[model samples]
Target: MSAYKSADQYRDIAGRLALPSQAFIDGEWSAAAAGKVFENLDPARGTPLGLIASCDGSDVDRAVAAARRVFEAGDWSRAAPEERKAVLLRLADLVSAHAEELAVLESLDSGKTIKDCLNEIGHEVPTFFRWYAELIDKSFGKVAPTAQNIVGMIVREPIGVVGLVLPWNFPLLMAAWKLAPALAAGCSAVLKPAEQTPLSALKLAELAMQAGLPAGVLNVVPGFGETAGQAIGRHMDIDAVSFTGSTEVGAYFLKYASESNLKPVGLEMGGKSPMIVLDDAAIDDTLVSSAISAAFWNGGQNCSANMRQIVHTKVKDAFLDAVVDKAKALVVGDPLDPATDLGSMVSEEHRARVLSYIEIGKAEGASLLAGGGASAGLDGAYVDPTVFDNVDPAMRIAREEIFGPVLGVIGVNSAEEALAIARDSDYGLHATVFTQDLDKAFHLAKRLPCGTVAVNGFSEGNVTTPFGGYKRSGSLSRDNGTEAMDQYLQTKTIWITLK
Candidate 1:
């Protein structure tokens, strides 16, 4: 009760939350053009937390038009770097100021733990704004040496009026991931938060306005993917789009782009990432803990979650025992409780999806090592942290991206075999390798075929490193680091002749 208090307190906030009820367009709170509203449910209790404006294509049109006007007006799209930097920094401070309010809001909205909400909204969200703010002036143009008579310059300019499509898993944090970089690069944006969890994003827009962002510079229209998402993708006025979601939906954006404006589309899609442990690696507490954390963190809803554990034969048995022991001890309870290690699934539909995959794993002949029975009496969308052993690479459980707290263990005879198994995936988003030998670590990392590889532990890198994927997992456009700016910018070369 110390950390997040009782269920009564959570219900108290949930019942009377000052949740936003409208779309943000042209820096004002506006309802959907159709005036439709959707039931925003708290996945923890499967109750209606509130109602949010259910926008559609018409709202997208209004938001996009607003973004276009601001871009053309140069109020934000052409603002000086330091000026943009100052505004973003102020927004970051505001996010920090309203941290607790946002944490509880998101925890209720998404069924994510309040602790996770705090870490994301209070820490990661603001860090992104500050990082991009600091990067604003530091992002330099290039000068190319030419013949003495000529001066050649290369520069990056904002790709006017971009559309940003967000995901539900880490709602506010993902918004910051795209928005901070886009704004820092001096682009006007039309943001669409996932309809299921739009509260924090709406709050963020409010804070941005308070931070002195001009009208029409940042607009957030929350809605279903079919209407608002398609509109943003197919909108003629938008110059580019950045998305984080499934591979299936990611392709639709490309289709929308091809059918309409042929806009540049950037995608950070799904993954069935692997955590590899070689025989030479220590089967100690650290290794065991890393294995569990990689697979179960955030209830394994992460895109880069290392849910596929590919371990060498020699250490497989010991590792499995340690993993099972630790997995059994995880507490699944109220998301608001700070002591809770695992929280509720985002929705009943998603919980069913994860449970279906568990049954599929059994039918496909993998052993249910732990979990998949019943979540300890805490109701709603709660799902147990599940693990499967003897998972073959060909099993559906190993190949598919089960976006839940499901972990599958596959054994290999040698390092080569482990590496081979890890690389065999339609996705190449992230991979982890644990090896005592330095040479072996580098060998696996170089050949993993993923965008980001961790040698000793599980990580997607900090804000400074680029994160995307190889193959179908992502586009050439990355989401973090200086590379994120590339998705929202266009290059220009200027040539001059000396007199």
Candidate 2:
């Protein structure tokens, strides 16, 4: 079956959409505390979408206070695990029911393709909620053997109120990533959706309430990073923070925690991941598709985007030929259209930033292969997926995180050279290795130093596997699977003496 509705159908939904424009705090949709607002625009047309509530420190305080109140009052936070699970499961169903509306909203606001948005909103989003809900009661505590007269027990408890600062790239999916586990763990939360994309978050709050989530259990405050984000970071009442964004911004959260309440911070920061095509690997359609998806999916705005391609000299030519051909054939047009393989950058500013990097790649002597700049006659920030070959390991384009639809190919003489170049980055969130030989794949995979290494393909694994980084790319805390619950729970020990 076709994966999406017609462009006219999507536009009709957008035209009549009830754009959320306020903070959802304490079960009410209210304006910013200071009555300030910011313009949210349609990235595809550069037109004003709506006026989002420009929350400041005051709004953050209000949201956190409400979360703390509900948590302490034994509402959602103290509910039975089954109760929380049921509520979350219902929320998942609600998401699926409204999938088309949300997918279109995301595509219009964030400039993500409607097909991708549907897959996430319709399938992945609900799956995350259901997965965490199923895990709620299955998680077991531990008992310790002690002296004959004494008994010891270890159990987990909710970590109280948490701050979830989301990124703009995967608006609802990232919300699902953090919220599912946090809410499933029975912790109240204050969410600060990125100012660039906050409408879906506000809408999510409305849905959570409709799903029987208690008042004050979940809140969303929308505003700029310096105001709403900073307030959440420095809020003394918040018990923990889970952030997914840039490396530079991740550092600031750590500082905020240190300077404020010292709440633990979980960060999934940026990466300069490499897609290594070893000499033994085939230069077939699989490798080309994986390489293209790694670099161009979501326009390469992902934190773990494999913008660096370290291919062996033996197969570099064929790999480049195949990938460039595929890149050129990718349709760069309307995100609402299912045929559009690539869409606009999230905003005009981001498009300019990416175009500048293309200029930088040229100045640094990287050979342009396919794509370079804006798609002709496109209204908004649409960009062609640019590929560059003959990239040196030392060049800025190869080393930095451009977070655009720009891929650079660096030729490596051997698997060892590829490993060395891949490991040279300060970040180690993810890496992809393509090799037919089992021993070589295992060798490179084991020594890659990243959090999750994909063998023979490009993947970040499914919800069953933990996702995070090893070095500066992430912290000790992880997301997805059972590990994600650890971010919102605390382990406690109980010792008793028998009379």
Best by TM-score: 2
TM-score of 1: 0.97
lDDT of 1 by residue, 1-499 (tens): 1245565676576567698989999989998999898899888888887788988999999998999888899999888889999999999999999988888899988888877888888889999999999999998899998999998999999999999999999999999999999999989999999988999999999999999999999999988999889999999999999999999999999999999989999999999999999989998888888888888888888999999999888998999999998998998888887777888888988988998999999999999989985486777898898889999999999999999988899999999998889989999999999998999999889999999999888888989999999988999999999999999889999999989
Candidate 2: segments with Cα more than 4 A from true spot: none
The lDDT, on a scale of 0 to 1, for candidate 1 is: 0.91
Candidate 2 lDDT over residue span 7-113, tens digit each? 88888888898999999999999899789999998898899998999999998889888999999999988899899999999999999999888888888889999
> What ranges in model 1 sit over 4 Å off?
1-16, 374-376
RMSD in Å for candidate 1, one decimal? 1.7
TM-scores for candidates 1 onward, in order: 0.97, 0.99
Measured over all alpha carbons after superposition, the RMSD of each candidate to the real structure, in angstroms, is 1.7, 0.9
Q: How accurate is candidate 2 locally (lDDT)?
A: 0.93
